[model samples]
Target: MTKSLQKSQSSPSLHPTRRFYWDTESLGVVGLFTALSKVVSLMVALLGGGMNPFTLFLKNGIATALLVVLVARVRKFGTLALYVLVGQIVSFLIAGGGMSMLLPSFLVAALASDALIAACGGYRRIGAVLAGVALYDLLGRAISLGYSFLHARENMAMVMVAGVFIVLGYLGCLVIGLPCGAKFVKELRHAGIIREV
Candidate 1:
C-alpha cells in the first residue's frame, strides 16, 4: 500500500477541540438558562404568598435541578458555577441587594458543584451531575436557612422542620431531573443541536 494512502486510512478525521472557557454558544446557552431560571424564581416568589417554606423549597429545588442538568449537558467545569454567580448577581440587584446573606450560600454551592463535577470525572457521568445538583440544592437551602435563623431570629425548631421538607424536595428533584436531563441531552445530540462532550 502507498504511504500516503496508509496514512490517510490510519488517521481518524479531525474534530474541533473543545474550549475550556465560555464560547459564544456556551455563553448564549448559559445566559438563556440563567435568565429563564430568574424569571421562574420571580414567578415562584410572587405565587408563594403565605406558602410554607417546604413548598417554596420544592419549587426552587426543581428549578435548580433542571438548570444544573441543562448547563451540565451544554458546558462542563466552571460554566454552571458561572451561571449561578451571574444568576445570583442579577437576582441580588433585582432585590436591591437585600439578600446579602444568600450571596455566600450561593457562591459556596456553585463552587462545590463545580468541584464535585470535576472530581467525579466530568459531566459525562450521571452520578456526578446528579450529585452536583443535589449538593447545590442542599447546601444552598441549608445555608439560607441557617442565615435566617441567625439573622432573622427565626426559630431553630421551625427551621429544622423546613429543612426536612427541603431535603425531600431535593430528593424528588434529583429523581425526576436526572432522567429528564438524560433524555433531553439524548434528543439534543440526536438533533445535532449539541455535540457530545
Candidate 2:
C-alpha cells in the first residue's frame, strides 16, 4: 500500500488524451527555467563585459549550471532543445539579427544532446542528464567555432583566439557548473521542490 501511494505521489499529472505529452506542470517548469537562463545570460554579459576571461567563465558556468538543473527538473525528452529554441527566440528579438547567426549551431547541439540523453536511459538517470548538459556545451561551442572560421576566413588567428576562450568556458562548465548544479539539485530535493523518483 505504501509503495503504491509513493508511486502516485511522484508520477506527474499527465495529459488526459496523450500518453506522451508535456502537461501543464511540466510546461510551467520549462518556461520558468527558460526565462531564468536568459535573464542570467544577459545580466552576466552586462556585468562582466564582453568575452574576456572573467565573462567567458562566469557566463558559461552559470548558464550551464542552470541548464543542468533545468534538465533534472524537467526530466523529459526535448527539454534541452525546447530551452534553446525559446531562449534563442528571445535573444533574437532583444539582440536583433546578430543573435540569429548562432541559432543553427545551438539548435543542432541541443537536439543531439537531447537524443543522447534519451537513448542512454532518459532523464530519470542522473548520469544521462549530466552527460547531456556537457555534450550540449561542447558541441555548441565547437559548432560555433566552425561557423566563426567560415565567416571570418580572413582572420583565422582571431578564430583561434576565440577557440581558446571556448575551451576555457567549457572548463568552467566542467569545474564549476556541473558540481554546483548537482549540489543545487540535492538541495532542491531536500526542500521538496524536486521530488525524488
Candidate 3:
C-alpha cells in the first residue's frame, strides 16, 4: 500500500481508543460516579422517606445530574453500559433486592442510550449527551413500571399511581437534572478537570 494510504488508514482521527476501550481514567471516572450515584440515592431514600413524589424527583434529578457528568467525563460509547452494570451489581450486593428484576431494564436502557448518543454524534455534542441521558432515565423507568405491572396485574390502580410518580421523577430529571449537570460540566471544564472532548 502507498505510504499516504497507510497513514490515512492509521490516522488518529480514525482511532478507536475513545470509543471502544476502557482505560484507567475511564474506569476511575465511572467508578467515582457510580459510587456517588449510589450514595446519593441511599441518602435520598433515607432522608426523603422513600418514594413519595418529592423524593422521587429529588433522587432521579440528582442521579441524572451525576450521570451527565459521567458521560461528559468519559466521552465514550460503552460508558453508560459499564455504569449501569456496576450500579446494579453494587445495589444487589448492598441492598439485596430485585436485582434480577431490574438489571435487564437498566442494561437495555444504558445500551440504547449509548447507541442513541453515538448516532446523534457521540458524547462530544451536548445535545446528544442530554438526549441520551434523558432516554436512559425514561426507558428505565418505563420498563420498570411495566415489570411491576406484570407482577401486580390485579392492582391496575396501584400501577397507574406508580406510573404517575415515575413521570414526576422523569420531569425532574429533564428540568432540574439536565441543567444542573450542564452547569457542572461547564464549571469542571473551566477548572480544567474535564477537558473538551
Candidate 4:
C-alpha cells in the first residue's frame, strides 16, 4: 500500500482508543442507570400502580435527564443513544424478558434522542438535554400506546385514560425533570464530577 494510504489508515481517527474513554464512561453510566431502573421496576411491581404511566414518566424522565448530564460531560456524540439502546436490552434481560415487546420503542427513542442532541449541538446545553428527554418519552410512550390500541386487549376508554396519563407524564418530565436536571448538572460541575464545557 502507498505510504499516504497506510498513514491515513493508522491515524488516531481509526484507532479504537480514540473512543475508549468515552465508551467506557458511557457503559458505566448506562450500567448504573439500568440497575437503578430495575430497582424501580421491582418497586413498581410490589406497589402495584407505582409504575403507572404518570409515575413511570417521572421515573424515566429523571433517569434520562441524569444520563444526559453524564453524556454531555463526555462531550461525545451518540453516547446517549448507545446508553438507551444497550441499557434497555440489559435491563429487559434482568427483568426476565417481560418487556421484550417494547424493545423497538426503546430503540426508536434512542435514535430520536441522539438526533435531538446532535441538532442541539451536543448535551452541554440544557436545551439539548430537555429535548432529548422529551423526545425519548414522547416517542417511547406513543409506541407503547399504539401497541396497546392495536392489540385491543383493553377497552378503548381504558386505553384513552392511559394515554392521557402518559401525556401527563411527558409534561411532568418537561416541568420537573428539566429544572432538576439543570440543577443536578450544576451540582456535578461544582463537585468536579462533571467538567464545564
TM-score of 1: 0.73
Candidate number with greatest TM-score: 3
lDDT of 2 at 144: 71
For candidate 1, the C-alpha RMSD (Å) to the true structure equals 8.7
Q: Is candidate 3 or candidate 4 better by lDDT?
A: 3
Clashes by residue pair, model 1: none
Clashes of each: 0, 0, 0, 0
- Identify the superior model by lDDT, candidate 1 or candidate 3: 3
lDDT of 3 by residue, 93-156 (tens): 8967765568887888899999999999989888899999999988988887887698778989
Could you tell me which 10 consecutive residues in candidate 3 have the lowest summed lDDT? 14-23
Residue 30's lDDT in candidate 1: 83
TM values, all candidates: 0.73, 0.82, 0.84, 0.73
Instruction: Kindly report which residue stretches of model 2 are placed more than 4 angstroms away from their true locations once superposed.
Output: 1-20, 101-104
- The local lDDT score (0 to 100) that residue 102 gets in candidate 3 is 86
Q: Which of the two candidates, 1 or 3, achieves a greater TM-score against the reference?
A: 3
Residue 81, candidate 1: alpha-carbon lDDT: 72
Model 1, C-alpha of 24: deviation from truth (Å) = 2.0
